[model samples]
Target chain A: MALNRKVGFFKGLKYKGGGPMWAWILHRLSGLAMVFFVGSHIIAGFLTQQFGSDVGIAINIVYENWIFQLVLFFLVIFHAVNGLRVTLLDLWPALLEYQRESIWLEWLVIIPLYVLILFTVLKSALGL
Target chain B: MQKITLKLFRYNPETDTKPHYDTFELEAEPTDRVLDLMEKVKGYHDGSLSFRRSCAHGVCGSCAMRINGQNMLACKTLVQDLKTSRITVEPILGLSVLKDMIVDMDPFFDSYKKVMPFFVNDEPKPAQERHQSIEDRERFDDTTKCILCGACTTSCPSFWSNDEYIGPAAIVNAHRFIFDSRDKGAAERLQILNDQFGVYRCRTIFNCTVACPREIQITQAIGEVKKAIATGSLD
Candidate 1:
């Protein structure tokens, strides 16, 4: 009862949770990233209103950076696809046996779409 | 016989301030079970080595421990299965270790008890028996294989973060009764599992499914429980 010690994050990482564990971790990380992005976006909008066009332009520069855009796009796409995978499996328990395949399917869907996004972002960043 | 190095976790509440590993070089057949290696070390090398073993055949689930980074029944895992001469054995994670390779199972069992693991049917008894169809029997057959080894629960990251989560084993047990046609406690069990600390804590990580020595489809079972709670339909 009193002896319960929380497993350290790195120690828990050592335990082989396999593909699903990675998926769970990614899903959580992406979800958090999206929340932070939205919160910062709202704050940026407020700053733009109070601090004038200079602050708005500075914030736009960071947001418009291709590297940040690529990472943000990845977080959004992965979170959506993985959330769909988890939701689909939760809705249909019989599909649970194909969980590994579902994870594969999620990657299959994410890769092509992410690649296209990467190409578009890279072209714009390079002025190509 | 092949040369193997057995690394065991050592700890004593009375003496050692922290746990440490003790290594023993011993020769054993590749076919020998990990439990056999532990026995040899305890019987010959050091009598101070401590671990739990009962039945020595994986039936009682007493010998469940982390073998080569995976939760497995030592009696059921062979030396050859490890594909290496070096073996590292430790207690399953999440619960507090009472000694070396032996954790306090009371916390694990407390979660099990919270799920109402026993059959509860307040309906009047039938003349001979409460008849169940073969189809109905198969509904909960997978979850019935749980030996309460604490492998699945301890392997869960959710449980490692918070012991109050009730982990996956309790959800599996809840699924067993939730789907039972003969049991009238489905509604009660569903209500119990509907909490945030209940079924929702499971992140669909599949660690419980992998850690289960019985090869139960633990994640599928938990999914079923979640569905039952959401729909309020045991079907």
Candidate 2:
């Protein structure tokens, strides 16, 4: 049988679930955000170092902005901590039986780090 | 006995352009199954309504559907377990529905066959039966409980998004033979499973594990296969 497009990408979200599905969705989105952010950051660095300064200047203005930095901070921390939880679960499949427990643990690890990063970025951004 | 309103999904692709739910009011004992509820509606209320069941004891895997927003064996789920005045019955997701409640399972079986779900032993026959250690049997024992029910596969998130991803059930079926000490078919099966649409496509959503009627630790089985293939170790 062919693919049923009626069951679209948000099929999982359509169902009420515990923490794992939401964690998976967030992990994917955060990972994607990191990929775009790093790709641009690397591209901007190379451009500034080699070609004209126009691309670099534009990227620097965005990078120096506190909102951009805070977004980057959120994305990086979320991706890393969730990635660690996923990796640990992968390495030990037995841990997956505790999917609910691990998700809370991932959040516990993520939130405090996220808050600390947020405050630091806020301090730096506000210049206070 | 209690009066329950069963809101069931109704669709005939040949006649209707879209799927819709048909509600049936029926009397049922608290101990009666969801399948029994459907039977009351079909026998007394309507005949054109469609569904499938055989053993009615849950072994046949024929009556698997979403009952009360969960993938479960209709015959295996009692009315009281749902605890709702209105029982919402729907076909399993990510599969084409053929009629009122039955889903087309041909594509689901196609993926099962892709795993070469039989023993492949080209070796010379021994005088005795093929031997397997207790430990080796224990390794893949969890996967052997699969009844070929589409519950786990239909419930998989990867199968929902990408229909070609070989789903969790097939991977679990493959895991049955991959770790069998007597079987010499791991390499060939691993090739198909290692494809881009293979086992790697599973994002560990764990829906299959939750939906499985046999209570197979499906995600763990999938992980064991992935770990085995990557390290070239069959432990």
Candidate 3:
């Protein structure tokens, strides 16, 4: 039965999907962030070669900022850890039933590592 | 008994320009099932309120709808389990909604059909019946629990994006037979699942796994199907 009452895009996002859903959304966002970062990195390199070294240096200053590094670190670490969780579940279907627990475990690995990353980044940023 | 506000997503093609929520405040026990609340609404409040329910238990899968925010069988989901007095009921996401809490399941079933859900054994029928080792039977045991509820499929992001993606329920069904030791149709089913709109479309998002009222490990089953496609071995 064809009906015009399809789920609107934003409405679909509002569903009470649990942790796995959030994981998926974050994974997608982190992946896109990585892609954007890589593209910008390449563009910065190109600008340095074509325009001048000053343009690249300016971009590097922004990138090397502590806030930017923390955000980038978060995106990279979350993406990798979540991707690993997905891969592990994919490889072992038996763990599928523990999908929720796996997400928690993913966070277990992410939290301390992220804290350490934060400590390192902040220490370096502050020249401590 | 607590008075709870039940908000249902209602749509009528003939009467309404767009879908709207109809809220009914009802006295209900926390122990009462969402289906019981729906029954009260249909019985006392609105006769025209449309939904599908059969085997009031979870077996039929007819009562599957979005309860609060998660896809669940209303009969199986008690109000106490929700922990919130304000309950929001809507049709499962992704599929075209036909009316109040009912969606066009044809597309869902069409995907199911593409998976060749039935057993295909070209081999002659055995003397008594085709025998299967316990381990062989156990290989597909999880997927066999699927009640063909569109819950898993409709909840899937891939299925939401593209209906032709042959959603998780179908893959679970395909996995049912693909791993069957007695079934001779794994090759054909695998070929069907290897299409562009097939196993590769799955992004390993566990929405299907969570949405499954039958508690089938849907993402795992899809992963198994993908692995089967990759390895070319059902073993």
For model 2, residues B1-235, the per-residue Cα lDDT tens digits are: 8999999888877788777888988888999999998888888888878999999997988988888767899999998988887899888887877787877888789999999999998999999998888987888888899987788888777788778889998999999999888899999998889889998998887778888899998988888888877888786
lDDT of 1 by residue, B1-235 (tens): 9999999988888788888899999999999999999999999999988899989988899998988888999999999999999999988998888888888888888888998988899888888988899999999999989888889999999899888998888888888888888888888888888887999998888999988999999999999988888887777
Least well predicted 10-residue stretch by lDDT in candidate 2 chain B: B11-20
For candidate 2, what is the lDDT? 0.84
Candidate 2 residue pairs in backbone clash: none
Candidate 3 - CAPRI tier? medium
iRMSD computed for candidate 2: 3.1
lDDT of 2 by residue, A1-128 (tens): 22243576655666543466677777888888888878888888889889878988798788778898888888788778888888888898878778778878878888998898888888877887
Residue pair clashes in candidate 1: none
Query: What digit string (tens of lDDT, one per residue) describes model 3 on residues A1-128?
Result: 33563566787788767778888999999999999888878888888888887878688788878999899999999999999988888887667778888888999999999999999998988988
TM-scores for chain A over all candidates: 0.90, 0.83, 0.90
Index of the highest-lDDT prediction: 1
Question: What ranges in model 1 sit over 4 Å off?
Answer: A1-4, A52-60
TM-score of chain B of each: 0.98, 0.97, 0.98
Interface RMSD of each: 2.4, 3.1, 2.5
